[model samples]
Target: MDKRGRRRTLSEHVILDAALALLAEGGADAVTVRGIAARVGVAPNAVYTYFPDKAAVVRGLAEHLLGRVNHDRFTDPSQPWRDRVRALALELRAELLAHPGSVHLMLGHPPDGPHTRAVRETLLATLADAGLGPADAADASYLVNVHILGSVAFEVAAPPGGPDVGTTRFRWGLDRLLDGLAAHVATGPPR
Candidate 1:
């Protein structure tokens, strides 16, 4: 039973929700098995039934959060490649900023889940559409990820004037990256 005296179901999703709430309330350190179990109206051992350890719980949280990022815009054939990439970067930034407390999880513990793979594949495809061969697309994808994650990590750590300022800076960096990519693609692989 919960604090309201209502019976609560114990499940992976329930545990994850508790973890997210704890993370939002007090950052990653607050998201422990006991904390989650208490929030979910269960014992610490019960949480272990769903997740073997704290690492697994953190992984689950990462997967759950990354699963929420929308990658559909990256697949829209109508848009130019830069526009598609921009949409993806913007959406990822918005999602990360939405959960400032959890941003570190993304940087420190890259989720190895279906959603993460999907986002990677989508970004690779989008780069390929921009005239990158497979090898170049892979390298470009790494650069793009670094830019987005690095920018968001910095913003979350030391927020600029406001979101607008951070976004403006993000756009400028992304544009420069795209411009370089355009030139590289136009010139073809170097000798």
Candidate 2:
């Protein structure tokens, strides 16, 4: 309140929250400093105090979105590991599809943030449950990641705004790929 003028922390969180809300409501393009400020009941400059640009806010929102995935239904420990992995992938794909523009923000972003690291760690842990060793876990985790991202990209890019193949066909694709991938897992440490 002194030299800072505005309550920057509260303003930043508010702005980030507004940005996510905007993304949820109108996809990526809807998120702007002005839009966030309007939603947060603050001036645009207040939002600017937190984020230098729309892109920075979007990156922060992307990180927030990744954090949500870590706690979502897909990470259920009661579910079998393979089932959990598939469900998580499907859930994430669905979320991205539902949001649309977040798909692009997600795809090319660097995996350097905390939320991203948590998601990756969770994924790697799930892969280890599938009997992958440390090295195999890393490799297979990345492979499965690529599959999920690639699949989601197609889902987001599809003309129907979702996959035309449906869940059965889509899951079938995962099954065929996993069947081969699991062979490598089975050979590793033998469980």
As a TM-score, model 1 comes out at 0.89
Q: Mark the regions of model 1 whose C-alpha exceeds 4 Å error after superposition.
A: 1-7, 159-165
Candidate 2, TM-score vs. the true structure? Answer: 0.75
Candidate 1: tens digits of C-alpha lDDT, residues 61-175: 9888878887865798778999999989988888877777677876666688888888999999999998899999999999998898888788877745655548999999999
**Residue 55's C-alpha lDDT in candidate 2?**
71
* Candidate lDDT (C-alpha), each: 0.86, 0.71
Q: Count of backbone clashes for each model? A: 0, 0
User: What TM-scores do the predictions have?
Assistant: 0.89, 0.75
Candidate 2 lDDT over residue span 138-183, tens digit each: 8777777677666666765678655474566668777776676688
In terms of TM-score, the best-performing candidate is: 1
